[model samples]
Target: MEQPVHHFSELFEQLGLASDAEAIEAFIQRHAPLPESVALHEASFWSPSQAELLRNALEDDADWAEVVDHLDASLRKP
Candidate 1:
């Protein structure tokens, strides 16, 4: 089964915010830099190592908006 989709609000909450899209965006950008070499649609490219690195970064930094915008754009890419 596929993982359920979450609204930006939910993501914000998960990231420890009360409720704020802008804030969530800020948090993600500060912490999660999109992997430059990974193809967004390549499922296999999102390996465990990549995930761990993302997780580690998120754990450390929690403030940045560009990351959220990048993620949104990447997801919309064809």
Candidate 2:
């Protein structure tokens, strides 16, 4: 079964980020609400492997998809 995402911090951990409360909040402050024109995979903040993980999760609709998608949207500029 797929795990429900409980917090942005969890998403950060899955994405290989720091995942601590301060780190997660800092990351969000820095990167959340990405511009509409910027594709998630093309974000400058991600390493190639990290981008690949997100791309694969989204393409496969795997267990990570929900959280990945949440991150994708969160990173977009409103």
Candidate 3:
């Protein structure tokens, strides 16, 4: 069976960011429209540990990967 996916709120909480709906939206608004050359894990706004968590989740396809991908997509919008 596939693992259940989580919400962006949970992903934000895991990243040690504010996890409320408003905060999540604010975060996306602030950092989104990522450059094509920069991957989510390579974004300059993340702390080292936060970046590592995202990198690992994507690399390992962890339970968090789905939500992480959602975040990645959100950031890519122009």
Q: In terms of TM-score, which candidate is strongest?
A: 3
- Top candidate when judged by lDDT against the true structure: 3
lDDT of 1: 0.48
Query: What ranges in model 1 sit over 4 Å off?
Result: 1-5, 34-78
Q: How much is 67 displaced in model 1, in angstroms?
A: 14
Query: Stretches of candidate 2 above 4 Å error?
Result: 1-7
| TM values, all candidates | 0.31, 0.77, 0.93
Candidate 1 per-residue lDDT over residues 1-78, each given as its tens digit: 643554657544544454576775564455444455654323343456544443554455444233544454644444
Ranked candidates, highest lDDT first: 3, 2, 1
Question: Which residue pairs show backbone clashes in model 1?
Answer: 25-65, 26-63, 26-64, 26-65, 27-63, 27-64, 30-64
For model 2, give the RMSD to the true fold: 2.3
Candidate 2 lDDT over residue span 1-78, tens digit each? 746545667767767889998886678679877888878878898999888888888899767787777777766744
Error of 2 at 50 (Å): 0.3
Kindly indicate the candidate among 1 and 3 with the higher TM-score.
Answer: 3
Task: Give lDDT per model, in order.
Answer: 0.48, 0.77, 0.94
